[model samples]
Target: MPIHERSLIRPENLVTHENLVIDGVDVSGHWSTFITSRTVTDYNEAMEEEISALPGGEHINRCWQCGSCTNACTVNAINPEFNPRYWIYLIRLGMEEELLRDKEILWQCVSCNKCTYACPRDVVPEAVMKATAHWMELKGHTPKSPSTHFDESFTGSVIATGKIEEGQVMRSFFKKTGQPLNQPWLIALVRGLVLKFPITLLMRLGLSALIRPRTSGWGRTQAALNDYVSEVEARNSKALGLDGKGKH
Candidate 1:
């Protein structure tokens, strides 16, 4: 279906004449307005396939342009340019360059699931948005988001020691996202904890922080997890036509 919304049309593409006459008829302003036509030649035909290979993008082929997802998108309500339906349309047609025009706003999906709930084809627009964001990051079209940094920090801590240290995860996440460790809110939180926790418990927590305790017999499990992560990364890279180091 064609997008008939005037706002969706780029101003440069819409041409208008202040005063005009065509075929002995006086037509100006809205009557003389026209959209410029152009041919697209830079399509990435494997885009849909590459996205499908990522988690949460498996059902991209089911989209039928019903517009339900966009109608229910929470982000779209706040930001008109954040259109999931339009992005999916571009992806299905492999219009990679056009899609990249909105690359910065693509990661703004809040995973509200309203779009998913409204989708008739079970497209799961929420997941598709996330997959698209991940694809953009892997393709180097955008940087890793703060949420991605936090997830990696939390996951890395658990995978390394089979347990998570809240303070360590927070520190790592802050470092990766270039945030200061001494925020006022964090300082207040630490002060409250210090005043509330018992002496022995606080000592144990301090000791744990220093020692970086690990789960017993985690060596074999860690090895298996590392192997799995490597395999998934290799598969994703292959799907995106990237080398082992994620370079094309």
Candidate 2:
């Protein structure tokens, strides 16, 4: 364990990511860094342009590293790399590629809305974080995070079912992740409860269903979104004299 507050620090050091403190105060030596400023400048510039282009992105540049959003972040409490403050700093500097390559860390955000709840400027930092991660993914960063994968699967699962079917989603997710199915006891318990308990009990099951993301008004909402996208794509394609798909 490193001593508190006095760990010899520099921009190039490769410090252990888990040792979070030196002298009981969080210090940034390794996990808190990125590629050199000279190499990152272009990326930073593009990042700023892309982010500020978003509806709420103008506020992204308004951050002064107050750390309020970081402090309020739930992910930061668990993993140090998931720092909203640092990433926002990266954004302010316009380090687009750095942020893009950092898709692994960036996608760790849970989007719990806590950062937004804590932002004094009402910057909606949580939404910005998610948007940045998604943008990075679209730009070829390729999301490698489990949360991102599960999030997509969960969304797809819910859309397929009126509500999330935990057993179904977990089976799919586990198969995808190469995790050996090991929830035998839980599965048995579920089966037992379903067999012994009333069907009404299953209908009233609130929490388990939440794990699979069963949302109300989703079918109509999804159809509306599909229609909206097709119309926009048709208009856009017409303007470009291309097919209704937004591809070249």
Candidate 3:
């Protein structure tokens, strides 16, 4: 559905005449306000296809503008400008410029999954938001978000060793995001783990943190995973026309 919400209109796009007369009647101020009309000369016809090519955006075409996703969105409830329905509409229509206008708020999605559950067509608006934010970063329209940094750190650990050490991932994430390791929550978590975790388990965790052990016979699997990840990255980069500028 076309967004006709007056609040969604940009203030600069709304023109108002302070003093105006039409047909022997006076219409001024808000009464004389009108939205500006402009032609979109640069529609990226491949925009939808590019976004769909990314993870979590595969079902973007299934969206029928039902508005259910927006209605159920947690962030939308707080910030109406964070409208998934509107962004999806713009993407489908290849309105790249219009979509970029809201690029900053795209990553604010909390991934509550309410929109996905409410979506009758399973559009998975939350995933679309993630994919869109990732698309922005890959295209260099925006910097990598803190969440993306965490994701990369976590994924890198797994791809390298095929083992997930919670503490290591946390430390890597904090380092990538320039956060201190002395976070209160992290300290509390460590304390709790030390207090309650089994003696053997705690020892293993500590040893692993120091040794950073790799899964046995993981070399072949690690190579395979690296190749798969490289393939996916290359494909996504080509789709977005990153021209070799895409971040891994």
Candidate 4:
């Protein structure tokens, strides 16, 4: 099959370098505002600072649409709609709305660093996926897929307990994602795997109670979440037409 007809934008049009469009919106008034709201960008600088800070950042500036990065990304290889190359292009160009809305396309990543491992210049598209997930979360947006919950629930349990209690985390995650505990067969399968390893079985049965993890202090985590809440509130206020988008 031919490639041109399948693409909405030709590969040639992509900017492999770090240039911005001067006409539509200046970086300050439009780009930085949208970027900062998502925590991926600071008011003074874009992801370029982080990208350039990477030892590979110098060549990242030279990525001239050869599709090397895109060809390297597993997400793009499987899903024709995904284009890591263009995503980086969007970040560089400061297409604010487009960048924010990009969050709607989620769970396309499997956290595989094959693209990063394969990059000749070390662009680290896997890091970009991580950045995108954090940015999306800041905007009060969530992925439709359960993969995220699969991680967050476990991690949240860890954050709360300093170690994961498999049984507790499973119940918590299932409740959050609206998934029920597995049927009897599934539970049996899991127990069978555990019981086969006596040491692991003893550990799972709470024989290691003396070494159980203690929780972290709540003061600092509360402060962090409070800051995030404030940022979301600020952005959502403007989103409700406070940014003069609704004055008419």
Per-residue C-alpha lDDT of model 3 across residues 1-248, encoded as one tens digit per residue? 23367776777887878888899888777756777897889999998998998989999999999999999989999998999999999999999899998877889998889999999998889999988999988877888888888889989999899888887997788788898868799899878877887797778877987898679889999999999998888888887887566364
- Model 3: ten consecutive residues of lowest lDDT: 1-10
What lDDT does each candidate get? 0.88, 0.65, 0.87, 0.57
| Top-down TM-score ranking | 3, 1, 2, 4
TM-scores of the candidates in the order shown: 0.78, 0.59, 0.79, 0.51
Higher-ranked by TM-score: 1 or 3: 3
Worst 10-residue lDDT window, candidate 1: 1-10
- Over 11-118, each residue of candidate 2 has an lDDT whose tens digit, in order, gives 454334545566887755654543333433354446665655543455786777889988988889998667888788877776655556467677777778888888
The best candidate in terms of lDDT = 1
Tens digits of lDDT, candidate 1, 40-70: 9989999999999898999999999999999
Ranking by lDDT: 1, 3, 2, 4
| Residue lDDT tens for model 4, 93-142 | 65545555556564467767776776666556666655555445533456
- Model 2 gets an lDDT of 0.65
TM-score of 4: 0.51
lDDT of 1 at 196: 85
Clashes per model (N, Cα, C within 3 A): 0, 11, 0, 1
- In candidate 3, the residue pairs with backbone N, CA or C atoms under 3 Å apart (3 or more residues apart, or in different chains) clash, namely none
Residue 3 CA displacement from its true place in model 2, Å: 13
